[model samples]
Target: MSLDALTFRPATLADTDAVVALVESAYRGDSGRRGWTTESDLLDGRRTGADEIHAVLAKPQNMILLAELDDGSGPRLLACAHIAIEDGAGYFGMFSVDPGLQNGGIGKRVLAQAERVVREQWQTPTMRMTVINVREELIQYYVRRGYLRTGRFKPFPYGDARFGLPKRDDLSFEVLEKSL
Candidate 1:
């Protein structure tokens, strides 16, 4: 499907499973390896879970944005991202695009829509995210999208199985931000 054919909508509780699957396929395991955004080499196990997504959905200031394409068939969940109002800025995370459809410009659209959701809907002035510092390619992708590296860092949770099991010891996150 063309980029114009994609649909953007806020995810509800009913969309939990599809959202989790889409995220896992894009970031972890063998499924994630099919996509350039995969962090399979850096981490292992689940990318996200129902409880976490449910928490995000339950919050009044947070939402999971889904990007779908209805190509004669029923709508297919192609991509998704988590947006939350942290302090005064929009925090973006849990971004995922179907591994099979990566590099097809779907991710770019989802990100743009996410920024719009925060800027227009929430009246937020800035968008921010944390990226695994080792993922240079992924970091560069966001840089090209206008995100600036803040030089600030957050230590990756080593004991948090919910995030993932790190394959290396030097894992950490770098902050990135953009004005809306």
Candidate 2:
């Protein structure tokens, strides 16, 4: 969908299935191959499930921001962001845009909205996320969004495919942060 035909809103429990599907399409499957954010090579399983989405909503300190198409055909989940409050800052993650709709302004606008929600609603001063270090393109996207590389690295949890199956053995995450 076009950016002009979209809207943003806080996701509710009812949106779990759609959101999970959108995210999977954006990252872990054949559809994801059409966009730059595809984790297809690195992972070959479902990106997320109902239980996880429901758990995010269950967290008092977390929220998932969703983007919806506004064609009145009803809200079609397009992009999403996961944010959690901790140590007085909002930790951002689990973001993905529908593969076919990437390279448009949809993901950017959704991220801007996520930042706004973190600051205005949670009163957080900073937003942070961990990106797999080898994802240079995605890292640059975050940099362009005003986040700075912190040079902090964390081991990629391999045995636990909860994140995704690794495409390379050297995978790990680097922390990036931005003040709100």
**CA RMSD per model (angstroms):** 0.7, 1.4
- Tell me the deviation in Å of residue 177 in model 1: 0.5
Expressed as tens digits, the lDDT of each residue in 116-151 for candidate 1 is: 999999999999999999999989999999999999
Question: Which portions of model 2 miss their true places by more than 4 Å?
Answer: 1-5
For TM-score, the strongest prediction is: 1
| Window of ten residues with lowest summed lDDT in model 1 | 1-10
Model 1 scores a TM of 0.98
Number of residue pairs clashing in candidate 2, backbone atoms closer than 3 angstroms, sequence gap of 3 or more or interchain: 0
The local distance difference test score of each candidate is: 0.93, 0.86
